[model samples]
Structures are given as C-alpha cells and as structure tokens.
Target: MNALAIENLSHSFGTRQVLQNVSFTVAEGRMCILLGRNGAGKTTLFSLITGLYYARTGLVRVFDMAMQANPSAALAQMGVVFQLPTLDLDLTAGENLRYHAALHGLPTKLSKARSREELSRLEVLDRIDDRTCALSGGQRRRVEIARALMHGPRLLLLDEPTTGLDVPGRRALEQHVRDLCRERGIAVLWATHFLEEVAADDDVVVLDRGRVCWAGPADRIAPELGVGSVAEAFALLTGSP
Candidate 1:
C-alpha cells in the first residue's frame, strides 16, 4: 500500500483558492519530489496534508487511513519537517530530540537510543550535546529531521528542508534523506523548488500555481513535456520565462 495519498484536494483562503484538485501518492520505500516555485502553493498543499487546516474538499490518506476521518491514526504514521525552523535554540540537539520522543510517550531508554541512532545516521551524533543555536544551519536542519523521525513514522514529509544551507550542505542533507528511504523503507515526500534536488529515479510531481502540471518519473519529466531537460520542462510547464 502507498504510504501517503491525496485525491482531489482543494483549499482556499477567503476568496483566493490556493490548491485546486491536487492529487499524488508516495509508495513505500520510495521518494516523491514535489517540485514547484516559491508561489506554487507547495506550502499550502503541505498544510492541508498535515492537517494544519483541513481542506473543504477532497481526501488525504496515510496508509489507507483517511486524514479527516482518522486524523490521529493517520498523523501517527507520519513525520513532518516544515519549511520554517522549529527547533528550540536554547536546547541541545539531544534535548530537542528527547522532547519530541517524550511527546510520543516513548520510554527514556528507547528515546535516547533512537535519538542517537537518528542523529548518527544524519552524521550529527558528535553534536548531540551542543546547543541548537550554536550548530550551523546544516547541522540544525539535520537535527530537526532526526527529531521528526523520533516516532519512526512510515511517511516522512519535508517542505523545503534544505533552505538556508550552502551548496554542499544542501546536497549532503538531500543524500541522507534519500538514503533513509532505501535503508529504512520510509516513504518520503520531499518538497523543493530547486531543480538540482531531483534525481532520475525519483517519482516527480510538478506543482504550478496550486495545480499539478506533470506527474511521472524524474527522468521522464523532460520527455513527457517534450523538453530537453527538467529545468526546461519546468519553465515551459509553469510559464516561468
């Protein structure tokens, strides 16, 4: 079964419709890139899927559990890292992770063990006791990701996770997340505007102004749009000049 699914999801604020009939799925042990520009309604789509606000129309399912009807069950199976920074700067990385694990009612020993495991996987185990504010941008992002996985959610949702990182940092973090899908069989929906983040093997969903302009394999996007490269296809589909 797919780890995440959306069908005909639409949302609006006042009179402005932000998402129109958005639909997609991320299967187990795979990564799906949600590609869109800054104003392409990617964040809004995340909001709906995460239940920050329920869409008036359509459905969101996590492992066949309806989000609106079975939110607790659906949400329990998911972990999310939003675009904005959410770590408590005063706390150490380990503390932040412990806090999250505690929220999920994990035992102390298990939380510590899992915290180490996740931070180690992200190559930030050495910084475990350091205050979050002192860590570099990349380190913080990695810590946040580790915290998100404290409960071992089947579906991992990341929105602009590499934001504010340098080139090497961004690439390293991206590679780590992709590795998680393979190693842990965690389904991932990674949202990003940067074309370089998409790999040939990934499933791709191109969102433009709240609508999906294309959906297929990463390598297939160019051919499907009749363009020579993914960047060219993005420009053509989104009319980005």
Candidate 2:
C-alpha cells in the first residue's frame, strides 16, 4: 500500500508559484529520498503535506487519508523532523522526549517505555540525561528522531536530517534510519541535498524549481546524471550544465 500519495499538487505565494503538478507515491515500508536544491520548494511541499500551508489546488493523502479534511487523523500516523533544530537547548534529552510525549497525549508509562526503547535504538540512551546543548550535533539529531518516533508513527518525514554531521556521523545515522525503516516497516520521506544519503537501490524523487524532474531508483539513473553521487544526479537532472 502507498503510505503517501500526492497528485497534481500546486501551491503559490502571491504571484510566485512554489509547486506545480507535483506527484509521487511512497510505498509502505520504503525509504524515499526527496532531492532538490535550495529554494526548490521542498519545504513548501512538506508544509502542504503537514497541513501547515493549505494547498491552492490538488490533493495530498497521508496513510490514505486526505490531509486537508482530517489533519489530526493524518498527523497521528505521521512524524516529522524539520531541517532546523527544534530541541530546547537547556533541556536534557530525556526531558525533551517527555515533553513531546505529553504534547502527543500518549500515556505517561507508555511514553517513558517507548522513549527508552527509541533512544536505545538510536544509540543515544547513554546521553538521555545530558542537555541537548552539550550533545554533539549528530547525537542531538538522534534525540530529535527518537522523540519523533515515540508516538510509533507509521510514516516518518525528515527534512535535511544530516545537515551538520561529519562523515562518520552521517553514515551512522543513515544506517540507523535504514534499520528503523526496515525493522518497523515505516514509510520514510527523507528530504536531502546530499548524495551519500542515496543508497544503491533506494527510490529517489528529484525536484527542480518546484517540480518533479525524475522519480525512480537511484541505481538506475544514468551514470553521468548521478555523476559522482545522487547530488550530482540531481544537479544534472535539474539542468546544471
């Protein structure tokens, strides 16, 4: 089953169009990478999906439900980690997770149990009591991810999830994310500009100027298109000459 299906989605800000006829399907249990350049309308698209910005036209469905008509229902099954850091700097990771759990209205006992499991899964259990400000960038990101998963969302959305991490950090987080998707069968929509995030067989959607230019498996793209990696493929597909 498709976890997310967007069709003919269009959005605009006054005279400027942000997305036009954007369409794609993210299968259940699959990890789909959304690739685009800065100002390519990735954030705009996510806003629409999350119901932060109503779509001017077209339809967006999450877990097979219309997002516009039932935002709460759709959101209940989805978890999102935005590009920017959202944690409270002074709060410990455990405290941050507890706050998120309360916000979601999960049972306290269940929330604590799930939070512990998630933190361990992300390899941040040891740092659970440490303030977010004191944690490394990658460790903090993991905490954010763990918080997102506390609700056991069926679909996960990440925007620029590995922005500041070093090579090892990025790879570690990638493996963790991959394992989470496979083990939990959660559909993932990972938005990024980096090529390393594009695994050999992963599906990719390339957006340019707010439109989808390509949607297929990473390994199948032309060698020249991907060039050295997926970022290069995105550049080539978007007409970078």
Candidate 3:
C-alpha cells in the first residue's frame, strides 16, 4: 500500500485559493520531495494532509485509510516535524520526548526505550539529560527528529527540516533521514524549496501558484525539461531562469 495518497485536494482561506486539485502518492520506503517557492501552497497542502485544516474538495489517505473518516488511525501511522521548533527550551531532551510519548499514550518503559534507541541512532543519546536550551541548533534539531520517531511511525513528514543549519549540519540531517528511509522502510514527504536537498533517484513534486506542475523522478526532470541538471530544469520549469 502507498504510504500517503491525496486526490483532488483543494483549499482556500477567506477568498484566496491556496491549493487546487493537488494530488500525489508516496511509496513505502521512499522519499518524495515537495518543491515550491514561498506562497506556492506547499504549507497549505501539508496542513490539509495533517488535518490542521479540512479539505473541501479532495480525499487524503494514509496507509490506505481515509483521513477524513478515520483521522486517528490515519494519523497514528505518521510523524511530523513542522517548520518551526516545537521543543520546550526549559525541558531536557528526554523530558520533552517523554511528554510526547505521554500524549501518544505510550507506556513509560516503552517510551524510554524507544527514546533511547532513536536518540542513539541520531547520535545525541549522550545529550539526553541536557536542557534543550543548552543544546546547539543542530543538536536540538536532532532531538526533535528523535522525538518524532519515538512513536514508531511508518510515515514521516518534515517541513523545511534543514532551514537554519550550516552546511555540515544540513548534510548530516539529510543523511540521517535517508538512512531512516532505507533501513526502517519509513516513507518520507519532505517539503523544501532548497533544490540541493533532492537526490537524483528521489521522487519530485513541483507546485506553482497552488497547483502541481510536475511529479516524477529527479533525473527524469532534467531530461524532460531539456536541461543538463535538476537545478537547471527547476529554474526553467518555475520560470526562475
């Protein structure tokens, strides 16, 4: 079954339309990059998929379960890391993770075990007791990723996950997430405008002015656009050239 599926999704706020007939599917153990400029409806689509806003004209399905009719079951299979930080600076990394586990109704023992496993995988287990305020930006982001995985979600959704980090930090986080997809078979829908984050084999979804303009493999895009590289293709497709 597909990890995520959206059909004919359209949404509007007040009188301004944000998304129009957006549709896509993410396969298991694959990463699909959502590419769009600012105000291109990427965030609006994410909000609709995550149930932050109801879709007026389309259907969203997670792991073959309808999101509107079975929100809890659909959401149980997914984890999300939003564009903004959601951690409490005053709390330690472990504390923050535990709080999330409690909200998910995870038992204490299982929560601690899963937290330790994920933190270790992210290479931040040693910092578990440190207050999040004391951690560096990269370290805090790692902790957030670990927390997102603590519930054993099958699908991961990340919005601009590498936004503030330096080059090395961004690369590290990307590698870690890629490893998660390969090793654990977790499907990922990573929304970012940064073209460098996409890999040649990754699936690409391009949105322009709240509409989907293209969806295919990264390598195919360059050839389809008569360009030498994905960067060049993106510029041409989006009319940024």
Record all residue pairs in model 3 with backbone atoms less than 3 Å apart, i.e. clashing.
none
Candidate 3 or 2, higher lDDT: 3
Candidate 1, residues 1-241: lDDT per residue as tens digits? 9998899999999899899999888888889999999989999998888899977899999999999998889888988999999999999999999999998889999999999999998999999999999999999999999999999999999999999999999999999898898889999999999999999999999999899989988999899778899999999999997
Q: Candidate 2: minimum summed lDDT over ten consecutive residues — where? A: 222-231
Clashing pairs counted in every model: 0, 0, 0
Off by over 4 Å in 2: 223-232
**TM-score of model number 3:** 0.97
lDDT by residue for model 3 (1-241), tens: 8999999899989999999899889998899999988889887888888899988799999999999999999888999888889899999999999998888889999999988988999999999999999999999989999998988899999988998999999999999999999999999999998999999889999988888889988889988988898888878878885
Better of 1 and 2 by lDDT: 1
Per-model TM-score on C-alpha atoms? 0.98, 0.94, 0.97
Q: Kindly list the per-residue Cα lDDT of model 2 for residues 72-175, writing each as its tens digit.
A: 99989898998899999999999899899998899989988888999999989999888999999999999999999999899999998999999999999888
lDDT, residue 178, model 2: 93
Better of 1 and 2 by TM-score: 1
Q: Give the TM-score of candidate 2.
A: 0.94
* Clashing pairs in model 2, backbone N/Cα/C closer than 3 A: none
